[model samples]
Target: MPKARRKPEALDGQHFEVVVVGAGMAGLASALRLAMFGKSVLLLEKHYVVGGLNSFFARGGRKFDVGLHAVTNFPPKGSGKASPLIRLCRQLRIPFEELALSPQSFSRIAFPDVDLKFDNEFGFFISEVERLFPREQDRFQKLLRTMEAFDAYSPEVAGDVSARSILGEHLQEPLLIEILLCPTCYYGSAVENDIDFASFVMLFDAIFRQGLARPLDGIRRFLNPILKRYEELGGKRRMNLGVKHFVTKNDIVERIELDNGEIIFADHVISTCGVVETERMLSSASQDENADDVSRISILESIAVFKKQPADFGWEETIVFYNDADVFRYERPDELTDPRSGVICIPNNYRYPNGEQMAEGQLRVTCLANYEKWVALDENSYRSQKEICRKAMLEVALGYLPNGNSMAKELEERTELLDIFSPRTIKKFTGHLDGALYGSPRKSRNGSTRFGNLYLAGADQGYVGIVGAMLGGVAVANNRILRGD
Candidate 1:
């Protein structure tokens, strides 16, 4: 059962052992872990709902998912195989079944001429890749072996290595390399052309080794349990409260002042807000050299609800990575207006824990976007631009659907609802400056700052995806707050 969220006004002079800012996955995980350890925890969120980037919004009697496409790093429930997320679940005491994870049927990566489908099973994925690129089978194996080195609980301390450099070493085929990099980089690329080796391997292990899965009942089904468990352990959550400033003494955060003018004391403060926002709260006078650069490129997402599923039109795969150009350019163009390459997800194709709801389907189409361009648009111009972009993006998305020609007709005819969320939406909802989907390229520090008790979690910590973000919270709680190591 989900616990009722309390208003921030209820907490005027509260004190806790630990105060966690932000109610995203990382903040939720941190509060849960700390409460499980018998520490009095106060979790705060500026938004009314939880999950932040991964959260959902409701409109016209329909609930639409936001940033969550799938749980990329899915650990099987009883397979006994070692999974990175399993450790976090164990520490958090969250039963795997509570997640209600449903593996993807298959995912398609499409280029100008080449189209490949990756199965959900690891063995099947390896077999399919080998079958498709038999000439480079040996190279594939070597790359897999090399990537395994990054399967640890912590980030690799090795000097930064780019994904491009790593792929070039193993394979000579440009298309194959682009295919491998497309999904991972799109999910969490800090750099324009390549991601750091640690991020590369993390995404590889999640999408390639472990495969993708989604909760049957959407994000609420997954989050409510954690919130329930936290409340059961005497943890408290105050919603609609934004941290205004941190009261520090001797380089340690001693208290937090909310935007509502309420001050609360805590021995330690863990911030799930990204580095820039966190730095702003610490003090306006303090300077972080990388604060401005923390946010990478943002995204533009269009969600279309239909009375019928794409599978009805012969589209079987749950996700399709679509590229129009012969040479894949992973970054948004300097102009930031046109998006030639993007991801298209049909959430209905997923195998739900329960029977399928073949009633209505959703197509979530996303592309890299420029936060600056989006935020600068006037009201009338913004609306006009969104409509134009939506139509263009829809045309491109239609081409990837099964029997795309006819599917486009069916979609236009049966469209129940359509909504476009820009970079500004992300920034407004998550409070991440510039609507950055992934935080700083710089890896998160070990949950510590100049102030010994102040720590960073969430995107600021350099982990992406729901599992990675939550684990970041657990790691920080264990290393900085709980263990004091």
Candidate 2:
């Protein structure tokens, strides 16, 4: 998977059929697609490694996946179907089996009154809901029918519809609505309280129909192959480089200026950076005066490595969506955490290759946090604040355990290491302005820009999560670049 780096001098007058900014999933997918279509592509990144927010990092000889807990849109093997993941693999001519995905046993969405453990299968999820709320069976069935009808996220269907409104139309119980929206919305939502219907449907199809799964060898195993395929397809990638500005002429982008002042011309430019960053990169001549500024939310994530799995302490769920009440509000809170809602992920629960289990377990706890607050603190104060928040979150997390009173004792006794990542850390590493998890809360764009030759993918295109982001990249490439629609 080694790639040749371009010397600064060699990049002066370099030209490519396509210039893609960012080496995240979306960018990688776009570059790969362009390469497969026999176009010369140059993929650029500001980071030393790929994967963007959905990648991994290593510390103390143990590797931990940064953003990906598990992927929702996993199409079963040999289904002979055309899913987003499947289509990309076939288009790239990479075998689907190379991903090595395994369906999770189950995950829990815990409420004060009820605890629902959902398997990957939709029938199982529906049946569990029906069993608990017997009278809501018909309602649940109607929801399934509606979701099936709206599965294909057409522009007309996805037009600015609020997810809260959509759920309200089907169910009356507040608890039921919260239960349905909790996992997917928290995973990736740009809006304050309501996500777009398209995002909702995308999450529904990915979680309910396709089911969730984890790569046997972690996220790297899944992405590395795609990256390797990108390289093999004749796509060129440049690491530790970023776009500084776009040179435009007559409403079309003709060239890109790098951070090092190197200029590269391109037939087309595809950007995976968010909308705000994209707008900033445009010169005054090409900048859109009416460009919308999106509202973004940041997060506080803590990683705790345990000497043993939580299963030993009667905590067997792979993921737990816990809240004090049955209300899930996904917004950037003034405080570090709401304590009412957050997610706990146990990566070690995944079925490893050849039935192998890890020697130790890793747990990740994530909640909404204010980026502005973190940015205001000095380095010393920031570290102190992170520790304070981590302690508070751990206390809240203990309540979700089987034996709440004794759980902390068990966890502390077996705790191997603890690491906390603040919003500032996220911004520093990923180059997101405010450490926004999924970019701004803007309406879905068709991946087109003011300039005819420039386009967008990833968060800027309004697709969130691993599958949605990658598919957004492919959609833009196929429709705009390849099909020329």
lDDT of each: 0.79, 0.77
TM-score of each: 0.93, 0.92
What is the clash count for each candidate, in the order shown? 1, 0
Per-residue CA lDDT of model 2 for 93-159, tens digit only, reads 6787788777776788888888887877777888888877888888878987887777544533453
Q: Write candidate 1's Cα lDDT for 1-485 as tens digits.
A: 11112343455547677889988999999899999988879999998889899888898788877888888878655545377667767878887777878888899888887787886678877887787788989999998888775543464343256878889999978878888888888887766767777777878787877878887668887789999999999899999999989877667776678999987877678998877777777754465545646656788999888887667778778898888875777665565445688899888878885676546878889988888888888999999989888888888877877777667877889999889899898986788877878876655646656677788998767676788889889888888777742
Tell me, by TM-score, which candidate is best. Answer: 1
Please report, as a residue range, the 10-residue window in candidate 1 with the lowest summed lDDT.
1-10
| Clashing residue pairs found in predicted model 1 | 251-451
- Residue 243, candidate 2: alpha-carbon lDDT: 89
